[model samples]
Target: MHLAHYLGLLHRSQANLASAFREVAAAHADEPDIEHLCLRQAAICDTHAERLHPFAERYAEEAPREPDRLHSTLFSGTRTGGIALLRDLQDLYLMASECDICWTVIGQAAYGARDRDLLATVRDGEGETAAQLTWLRSRMKQAAPQALVVAD
Candidate 1:
């Protein structure tokens, strides 16, 4: 079934999000708030990974689970300043927005499959993700002035 494919892709995306979050937490030393948020998001992603396992197995249905690939969102070069951290946060926002789309797709699939568990989880996660998007946008607003200032 296509559930296997959807779950697989979602699982991989969550893992990458978690990795990026942890990396940002470590790399962006000056932005304590962003670091904390990233760590929290990483934990959420880990939870999502766990939540997805049974779904993947349940709907696999001889579909030979399409190989899950790591979609890397690596930011190259040395990290420095609030600007760098802001940019990282912005990138995360973009990823999260895309994830919003994935979640919507999952919801649609859930309706077709008539899977209550999948529907519930997708709906709950979508709300939580919306909160995350809001928080990230607020963080960006708070960081912008400091990030935009140049040394005199």
Candidate 2:
């Protein structure tokens, strides 16, 4: 497949993932901690989609489409109990990792084509996403319940 096709896929996947997170966030909105984290994560995904939209328009043969399978799988995976919360956080981490992979591939392709503008834009977006992931990690750490101390 062409680079544009791959980038478009990534963009759609990011958007779909964000939408799934938003759904989960809405479900858990009463829980302030989880809700805040989910909202932040949803914002990051929205930002990623926005950043990739221009590239998709310029490079792709058509507009990006939603990644239905990924979205469905993510939603199904998070449809449980406390397990869902943990799964949601894990999914966010996985999505962030995928974003890094996509950025690396796109950046390499842009460098090979001598496309400085694309490279710069993708790199900046990647950096922001990475930072957001770091923030999410910190939030996850905070959200994790402390282990009970056992009596000897």
How high is the lDDT of residue 89 in model 1? 77
Worst 10 residues of 2 by lDDT: 143-152
Model 2: runs farther than 4 Å from truth? 61-67, 77-80, 146-152
Give me candidate 1's TM-score against the actual structure.
Answer: 0.84
Best by lDDT: 1
* Per-residue accuracy of model 2 over 1-152 as CA lDDT, tens digit each: 37786687678767876776687687767667767777777787788788778778778634344466656665664455554555566666766676677788888888887878789878886887788678668756655553122221
RMSD of each: 3.2, 3.8
Spell out the clash pairs found in candidate 1: none
* Candidate 1 displacement at residue 33 in angstroms: 1.6
Give the TM-scores of the predictions, in the order they appear: 0.84, 0.77
Model 1 regions lying over 4 Å from their true place: 61-71
lDDT of 1 by residue, 9-123 (tens): 7766776777777878888756557678789988987887677777778877222222223234344544676588778878778767766777889889999989999898898
lDDT of each: 0.73, 0.70
